[model samples]
Target: MEDNSRSKNRREFIQSGMRLSLALALGSVSGLALSKVVKDEYVWQIDPFECTQCGRCATECVMTPSAVKCVHAYDLCGYCDLCGGYFKPDANQLSTAAENQLCPTAAIERRFIEEPYFEYIINEDLCIGCAKCVEGCTAFGNGSLHLQIIHDICLNCNECAIARVCPSNAIKRVKAENSYLIKGDFSKEQES
Candidate 1:
């Protein structure tokens, strides 16, 4: 009788173990089916028009040195020798002197284009996204200089730190294909 009881107990334990294993496998499968896979379908972008150049981008981004960089729209650019984006308002001369430069990082590189035009290029590595150049450009010249998210440097966080803190609500999630909001493109569209 004792042997019979032990055998029954062993059978019950084996059945319970098998049931638990089956339940676990089914639960795992159900979880996988219910869960949605997230692809890299979207990325963070800044609309140049919406941006107020509040200078928050330089400090609010999660990445040290920030993934934001200045992009100069050559087509929109007047290519002025005395670029408002490059030179301080009180500049003594239209020279490459650090004192006369508006960019604190000296990111805007000036090159002589013609008698009066000078092409300004942004050094992405040196740009701090301070928007001082953007403000200066808009205030005194054609608004060609603007900030853009460098996707290669950007982590593409689900919730971007800069977007949350943006005073102007400029930052937004964009389709990866249409990530960059170029200044000249918008201007051309509006002109047409």
Candidate 2:
């Protein structure tokens, strides 16, 4: 009788284990379905028009180095040698010296385009999305320097951490097909 009871207990345990495994699989599938829906309909993006350059994009994101980065609208850019986006407003001199650079990371690289026109290129890897350059450019230049979310790096969290803390309410969901709210059109580069 004792042996029979032991076998019955073992059978009950096995049954319970099977039930739990089925439940877990069903739950996982539902989660995957929800995520798929989100991916298909929308993606996280920043509205450059509403952005106030409040310096939160760098710190509010879940990632150590936030997914947001600076992008240049070259069409709107004057390509000035002394770029407001590149140099500090009160810079002692308009040089590439660390002290004179507006960006803390020196992410904006100034390349000589011609006699006085210097192209500013963003190294996304080095950018921290502090928006100091954005602020400077908007104040003094053509407002070509804008912060954008690099979708490749962005996790598209269901509730974006940066969006929650954004002072200007700039971050929002946009359609996957039209994910970017670019200040300067980049279609010409894409065509080439």
lDDT leader = 1
Write candidate 2's Cα lDDT for 1-192 as tens digits. Answer: 999999999999999999999999999999998786755568889988789999999998888799999998888999988799999888999788899999998898988878978889999999999999999999999999999999999999998999998888889998989889787664444557
Clashes of 2: 0
Query: Candidate 1: what lDDT?
Result: 0.91
In model 1, which runs have C-alpha deviations exceeding 4 angstroms? 1-40, 189-192
Model 1 over residues 3-77: C-alpha lDDT tens digits? 999999999999999999999999999899768645549999999999999999999889989899889988889
Cα TM-score of candidate 1 = 0.79
Residue 19 displacement (Å), model 2? 16
Clashing pairs in 2: none
